[model samples]
Structure formats: structure tokens, C-alpha cells
Target: MELLFVFLGGAIFGTIARYTLPHRDEHGSVLVPAIGAVVASVVWVALTWLGWAWDGGWIWWVSLGASVIAVVVADLAIGRHRVQTDAALLTKLTGSTATATAH
Candidate 1:
């Protein structure tokens, strides 16, 4: 089915985008692909229900576009959270503690 193709394409695009991010190691392997598939599936279903036929090129375009966008936004949010968390941990651990000895 065309919907299947669109979902698969979206998954590939989304996964690539996520993995290509600067902080790819911060995320789990499945997170990007899973979210991509979900977003793509949801968009495909919604547009079809709204009368956009599966055969129409717009259906593929819209679904895949939404999936990519969702992945990008998710990456930004997750990356920012990781940065903040790391900064907080560092601050807590290095609280101006220093030792000095007079010779």
C-alpha cells in the first residue's frame, strides 16, 4: 500500500536525521525510529480520513514531512535537556572546591 511506503520512507528519513545530530549518543537507538514511524502513520491515517486518497502524491509528501519535522523538534528538545542536565551535574560536583598547601 502507498501508506506503507510513505511510513517506511518517513522512518528512514527520521532515523537518519536523529542519528546525524551532534549529540546522537545522548539518545537511545529506538527512540528516533519509533517516533518517526508513529508520526508518519498518524499523518497518513489522518489525511486519508480527511479525504486525501492514498494514491495522491500529497499524501506521501505531507506524511513524510510531518515525520521529519517531528523528529527534528524532538532532537532539539532532547539535546537541550541533555545539555542542561549535564551542566547541572557538573555545577553540583565542582562547587568551587579547591585545595591549596603552602610550601
Candidate 2:
């Protein structure tokens, strides 16, 4: 199905985001790609519901583009938040401002 192609494209974009972004080690290998695929699926469905033709070229562009943007944003935000939270936890437990080592 065309949906499968969209999912695959989204996942590929997500994989790129995962490896290209910092703090990749903080999250599971599947997380970024999964997020991408899901976002792409959601976007595609939403567009279809809005009356966009499934066979339209623009639909695919928008869906996959949205997925890539979502993946990168989410990856960056989650990575930053995890680092901050981990550092805070470490500092609390150790009674020092010790930071986590970057991978």
C-alpha cells in the first residue's frame, strides 16, 4: 500500500535524525524511527480526512515532510530533557552538580 511507503520514508527520515542528532545514546534505537513512522502515519491520515487525494504528489510531500520535522524536533527535545533530568537526579543523589557523560 502507499501508506506503507509513507511509513517507510518516515522511518528512514527518523533513523537519519537519530544518528545525526546528539544524545542518541540516551534513547533506544527504535524510539526515533518509531516516532517518525507514527507521525507520518498520523499526518497522512489527517490529510486524507481533510479531502486530500491519496494519489496527489503534494500529499506525500507534506506527510513525509511533517514526519521528518516532527522526528527531529522530538528527538532534540527528548534528548535535552533526558540529559537535564539525569543531571538533576545525579546531582540530587550525589549532593553535587555532577553531569552525565555525553555519548
lDDT by residue for model 2 (1-103), tens: 9889999999999999999999899899999999999999999999999999999999999999999899999999999999999978887876674333331
The models' CA-based lDDT, in order, is: 0.82, 0.92
Cα-lDDT of candidate 1: 0.82
lDDT tens digits by residue: candidate 1, 1-103: 7767877887798789887876677778778877888899999999989999888888888899999999888877887898889877766777632411221
Q: After superposition, how far is residue 51 of candidate 1 from its true place, in Å?
A: 0.9
* RMSD to the hidden true structure, all candidates: 3.8, 3.8
Let me know the TM-score candidate 1 reaches against the reference structure: 0.82
Return the clash pairs for model 2, or none: none
